[model samples]
Target: MQSTLSGRGFRPGDVHTLIVPLFHVTGLNTIMPTAFHQGATLVVTAQQSPRDILALIERHCATTFFAVPTTMILLAQTPGVEQHDVSSLRLIAYSGAPMPLRAIQRLRELFPGVRLHNFFGLTETTSVTTVLPDEQALVRPESVGLPPPGIELKIVDDHGDPLPANAIGELLVKGPSVVKSYHNRPEASAEVIVDGWLHTGDTASLDEEGYLFLQGRKKERVIVAGENVYPVEVENVLTRHPAVAEVAVIGRPHAILGEVVKALSCCDPTPTLTSGR
Candidate 1:
C-alpha cells in the first residue's frame, strides 16, 4: 500500500521528507519504501510529538502522513497544530487501533479536505486489510474494511465451515502479504496459520451490505445459563448513567447460573448517589 501511495504525483521528489521510525514494520515495509520507490524525501524523527510532526509537515511541505489512532488524537488536540501550513497533507493513513466515531469526526473537522484511510491487520499479516477513500472512514467506521486487492477473507464457525454472511464468527485471512510462519517457531505457526487460514480470534459479523462489524474478543463472551452475554454491551449501557465515568463488567461464578454478570464502576468527579441511598 505504501509503495502504491508513494507513486502519486503529490509526493515530493526530495526523498527525505517522508517521516518514519525505521525500526517498526510500517517503517520497514510501508513508510520507507513509499518514499524510496517514489523518489520522495523521507523525514526521520527522533520523537513523535504533535508539534514536531506538524513542523515537519510544514517544513517539508509533505503531501502525505500515516500514523496510529493515538497520535492522530494528540495532533488534533495540540495547541499550535492548526497554525502550521499543513495544506500540503493530502493523504493520511491511520491504523493500529480502531478510530472511534468521536475521533473520526474530530479529524474531519481538523482536516476538512485531506484523504483519510483506516487499515486493519496484525504484524503477522503484514497489514492485509485496508478501508479505502475518506468516505468509508466516516460512513462505515466499524469495518476494518474489504481485503486489500490480493487478500482473501473467510468467516467460519467453530467447526471451520463457512458461515452465512452477517453471521458472527471467527475471521480468517490468507494472502501474499501475510507471513507464512513465525520466526523459528514451527509450533506457533501451526497454531495460528492452519491450512491456509490465520485464525484472528476476534468475533465479528458482516452486514447485508458486506461491511464488517467487530465485536469484542471471542474469549470475552460469557455463557450464563446457556445465554451468551457480552460484557461490553452491559458496560455500554451502564455508562449512560450521568454519574458513571467508566465501567467494566465481568463474569462471576454463580451456583445456579454457572456464571453471572458483575459490574465495577468509576463515578464522575461530582458523583451523586443519594437517590439510590
Candidate 2:
C-alpha cells in the first residue's frame, strides 16, 4: 500500500477526484469539495463507467480516488484499467456497504501500491464514523474498522449497557461529525439520538482490538431455530461457489427447524454444484 503522504509530503493544494453518484452523501462530502478545500479540480460526470473514471484520473492527474464496493468491482473487471496512468492515485477511499472479500482481494492484486480506505457510516452520522485502514484490510477484511478521528463508537446491548468484546449489539456513535437532528422529524431524531449518541440500528461487534465488524441491520436479522442469522453471512458463503455470481439468503418456514436458510443465487448459464442437493 502507498503511504498516506505523497513523496513530496502532504500538499494542501493537492487535487483529488471522485466519480460518484450525486444523490449520495459521499459525493456531497468528498467529491464536490475537491475544488473548494484543496484548490483541486472537480470533474462532474453523469455516467459512472470505469473507463470514464480511469480516463479522468489520467487526463487530470487525479491523486485521490473514491467509490463504493460495486464501482470497485467494475474497476477490477474493466479492461485496460492497468493500461491507464492511474499511478497518480495515492488514496482510494470506498464505502457505501460491506465489500465482498473477493473484490477486496482483487483490488489489492490490481493496485498493489495504492491506499484503499473504507469509510463506514450513515447519513445521520454525517457520512462517516469509521475508516477501515489499508493495513488491516487483508487480514481483517470483515472489520469496518475503528471509529474515525473525533467519532466515538460503542456497542450496547438491549439494556443500553455496553456489551463485552465480540458480542453483537446496536452500534451507537457520537461525534462532532454526527447530525444533530433530522429535518421536519423530531420524532425520528428522538428515537435515534439519545444523549448525543446516535443509535445506528446497524448491529456490529467490536473485537478486543476495537475493530468493528458489521452484522446485519436489526430489522434484517432472520430468526431461525430460535437463533438469529444474518442473511449476509449465508449470502457470502453461497457466493463463494464458482457458478454463483450473486446470492441472496432468506429464512423460510420449515416443518422442523421453524425456519431454514433458503439461498437464491444468480448462477452462470452453464453451472455445476459440488454440493449434493
Candidate 3:
C-alpha cells in the first residue's frame, strides 16, 4: 500500500473515494491501507452508481479515486458527467481487469488534467505489483508498467525456463508484499508459491524496457484442434470493431476440433451479427 501511494505520488491529507467492494483486495488491502497510511480522508460508497460517485467527488472534493475498469467505463458513459465538478481529482487508479483503449481515451477526454494509472495485482500479492504511471499512460497504454518499488517480475515458460523479452509466458512475481501462504489452503498455496516466486497464472509479455503487457489468464486458454487460442487476443481484435461495446471469448466443445473459440459480444445499436448465435 505504501509502495502504491508513493509510486503514484499520493500525498498526506488527500481525499480518497472508495467505491470498490471491501471484500476485494483493491479495497481491503490497497485503497484502504493506502488512505490510512497517507492520512487521507476516505469517502466510502456502498454502491457503484455513477451519480453517487460523481456527487461524492463533487461534494467532498475527492483527490484520489480507485475503481475497476468496469466502473470507470460506466462513469465515462453516464449522462451528465460534465455537470459534476471533478477538477479536484489528482489521481485516478484502475484495476481488476484490463482496461479498454477506448475507455482510457474517454477518461482522458473527460478529465483532462487528472493523472490516470493502470494498476495490476492479485489477492496473493496483497494488491499492486505494477502500475502504468500517468506519464506513460498514453505512451504505452497497453502495458501494466514496471514492477512497483520492491517487486520483481519475470516471464517463464511451462518448464520454468526464463523466456526472452516479448515472449508471452506465465508471469512470476517476487516481492516483500507477496503473501507467504494462503489461509488454511496449504495445498493451493504450495501450487502457486515456489521458492520465493509466486506464479501469477497470468500470461504476459515484457518489452525491452520491462513494461508488462497482459495476454490473458492461462486458465482461459482455448484449445482449438492442436492450437492454443488466447481469449484476450480475440477480444482485443473484436473490440476494435466500431459497433462492439464489450466482448468476452471462451472455448466451446467441438467433437472434431476438441474445442472451438467462441466470442460473445455486446453491440451498441443491436448489431446484425446477433442473429447467427
Candidate 4:
C-alpha cells in the first residue's frame, strides 16, 4: 500500500527523519513502511524544539521530514533558522492537521529546494487517504488532493444518498488500506463501516477535477485543546440537570485549541433559573 500510494515521492537511499510518533498511523503505515519499502534511510530522533530539529536535519543530512502542522510551523518560523545548512532536505510532508498559509509561505522561503506536500487521512485508513502533491500544495491548498490509485471516494448527504461533485456531504471511503472493523468495538465498527465503505464522519466535497476539499465534521466529535470531545456525551450529562429541558451541542473556533465545544440549551419554563441568583 505504501509503495503504490507514495509513488514518486519516495526513492531508494532517501534519508527520512522521524518526528511524528511511531505508533501513529502516519508514522507506522505511511512514513516507516514507505521508507523501508523504497530502501530509504530512517533517522529516529527525539529532538522537538525548532533549533534542535534544525540541528538534527543538518547533522543527519535528512532528505525527508514528516510532522504535524504545528511542528512544521515552529520549524519554518524558528528564529535564525536560515543559518543552518538544511539544503539536504528533498521533501517536507505534513498531515494530522491543517497548515496555516503563513507557515506554508515561510517554509517555501526556508527551503526552496524542498518539495512541500500535505496529505490527509485518519487512523482508520492507515494513513495516505489523499496526498496533496508538491504541484498542488499551493494551487489547491484547500483540497486534500486526489485519492491514490485504487482508492474509492464518495460523498453522501444526510440521507446517505450520493452527492455530485462540489456538493458538501459526509465522506465515505473504500480501499484496501481501510480497516474492516474496530477491535472489541462492535457498535463503533457497525457505525463506521457499512457495505465495505468506511463512513469517515468528516464533511467534504470534490471539485470538477476530483480534488477533495474538507468542509468540517458531520459527527458528534470535536477537538478542544487537542482533546476529542463528543457532543453527545456532554449532552447526555447536561440533560441530567432538572432545569435543563433541551440542549444542542457543537464546536466553535478557538484561537489556540483550534476548536472548543459549545452547547446551546433551553431551560424549563416552569422552573427557570435566573442568572447570578
Instruction: Sort the candidates on TM-score, descending order.
Output: 3, 2, 1, 4
Query: What is the TM-score of each predicted model, taking all chains together?
Result: 0.78, 0.87, 0.92, 0.78
Please give the RMSD of candidate 4 to the true structure.
11.5
Q: What does candidate 1's lDDT look like per residue over 1-277, in tens digits?
A: 6423522223547334333466667667766765676677777776578888888888888777877777786776567667889887777877775455556777788888987777666677764354545778777765666665667777788788888887877878887877888889999899989877788887776666656666657898777998877775576567556577557889999999989999998776776867773
**Per-residue alpha-carbon lDDT of candidate 4 for residues 85-108, written as tens digits (9 for 90 to 100):** 999999998887656555677898
Return the top candidate by lDDT. 3
Per-model CA lDDT versus the true structure: 0.70, 0.75, 0.88, 0.81
Q: How does model 4 score by TM-score? A: 0.78
Candidate 4 — which residues are off by over 4 angstroms?
2-8, 220-277
Runs in model 3 deviating more than 4 A are: 270-277
Sliding window of 10 residues with minimal summed lDDT for model 3 = 268-277
lDDT of 2 by residue, 46-160 (tens): 6578888888888888877777788887787776678888777777778887677777788888777887787686878656667778887778877877775567889998789
Q: Please list the Cα RMSD from the true structure of every candidate, rounded to 1 decimal place.
A: 4.3, 3.8, 2.5, 11.5
Candidate 1 regions with alpha-carbon error over 4 angstroms = 1-21, 229-277
